[model samples]
Target: MARFICGADRHQVTLLPNRLDDYVSEDNPVRVVDLFVDELDLTALGFASMMPAATGRPGYHPATLLKLYLYGYVNQVTSSRRLEREAGRNVELMWLTGRLAPDFKTIADFRRDNGPAIQAASRQFVVLCRQLGLLAGGVVALDGSRFKAVNTRDRNFTPAAVRRRIEQIEASIARYLAALDTADRQEDEVAHVRKVRIAERLDALRTRMRELQAMESLVEAAPDRQISLTDPDARAMATRGKGTGMVGYNVQAVVDTEHHLIVAHEVTNVGHDRTQLAHMSRQGQVATGHEALSVLADRGYFSGEEIL
Candidate 1:
């Protein structure tokens, strides 16, 4: 038996109550989130239910949910389910929300219903940074990256993809039909089974072909000649790697060069950065509260129309 340092007894009780604040420090980032949300005029910012309803059961205060969201975002816990779990276990979150744990649906509903208000809150942070001189520089850098959406490649369709799929299906059907023809010329039990299997495959292929034809019509009628079954706004965007692409959204961001702070950002379905330079540059200028600003971007954003 090895002797170890003695530990406190689990049954031991303390005469003094331990305050939740004792677990959090004055400089903790969660404190910043709490203070920021507390100071915001949520009603003016368009957050729903700033006050409890005049009648009926009251809901969780928007401030409480906002604090939880901010804390979760800062900690990279974006999933509502994960946030709910954290609220139950995280000490900082316990203090932030006064130990009131809302379910995942409530958390998700807040985000879904308050998208514009949430965007306003994000802009408010940039405004605060500008007020603090973090965005003093008039120079900014613009860049865009493809973020994979929840949509899978199979769920997305383009005119070219539809054509390729049709061609492949047609080739498969032809091969099965030729095999069936060969089976018809044979005189054996195995030949009959082979013929049946080949016929089944051909039938399945025909059904698939009909589905593809319907999808082709939809793709052709689409404004961008593409459709994503999962995320309608998602698009097929090319990656940096050659011959690689993903079904996703393009996120463009303009950052102040001085403090490396994001001044403006946009989520777009358009896959390329060529047309985003001017728009992002103007947004950066507005975010920094500057009359004029200089913008720098990679060659990918070099477009004659955008520059002129």
Candidate 2:
């Protein structure tokens, strides 16, 4: 007792390993995790390559990556980098993936390579809801929301705004040219005349005009004139219930009348809901296999043609 040892020879550490299996059993927050895994056709879901027959080392299974993604989405952790961290630290994620932590690149690649599959998986959830009698084909609600874009304010331009800018620039160029001509006539020897500055401004304006023209050309070439730096597919649309509205895309979904389960969804650049009724109705019809369906939309979706 008098001679105290500084460190134990074995240096036994009592760190508790994450027991993911036990947590995934009955009464867990994600009880359906097992059911979902068991019912899913992982091979057909485009994750066949995730489980490779490698020699000694185990490869990252696609299920692991998918589960991570699903969990991340459920918790609003959509970033790949954040998901990577969760895999390493979060107990639930550790259990979900069986303690296998895939790198961010791997997680990102899974998402990129399986975008269609992921979308299909979401649809499968809707199909499941339908099967469970959660969705009894009935009246559906329609709504949309706008999300901010990554493009800078200066880079974005409406057709009318662009035309106005071009006109102003042209006017400025004309005035500059007139000033230059007057300066030449008045006397080339006018010592302090800022002809070069005016000419330079005119040249810059011309350059901007060319850039604007190029952007216009791009817009013409695009299927949709709208572009977003962050999500290239995202569009600028208006909000519903209209206080002021936002600059983002209209995300429409068909919710079942009985349990309000979403049967179908679409994203559109069109701001107004007036034009959405027919398109959403058609989509709902296709999703539900119904010839005629009742649609209950907010006043925003009300239109003469829609009623017709």
- TM-score, per-candidate, Cα-based: 0.89, 0.70
lDDT digits (tens) for residues 1-308 of candidate 1: 25988887889986754899988999999999999999898998999988787999879999999999989888889999999999999999999999999999999999999989988998999999999999988889999977899999889899888899999999999898889999999999999999999999899999999999999998898888999999999999877798688999999999999999888999999998899988988899899999889898999998999999
Number of the predicted model whose TM-score against the real structure is largest: 1
Task: Give a tens-digit lDDT track for model 2, residues 223-275.
Answer: 76654445565555534465444455667888878776678888776777788
Candidate 2 collision pairs: 237-248
Worst 10 residues of 1 by lDDT: 8-17
| Residue-level error in angstroms, candidate 1, position 144 | 1.1
Please state the error at residue 207 of candidate 2 in Å: 1.2
* lDDT (Cα atoms) of all candidates against the true structure: 0.92, 0.73
- Can you tell me which runs of candidate 1 are displaced by over 4 Å? 1-17, 51-57, 186-194
Give residue 244's lDDT in candidate 1 (0 to 100): 82
Cα RMSDs, all models = 2.7, 7.3
Query: Which model scores highest in lDDT?
Result: 1
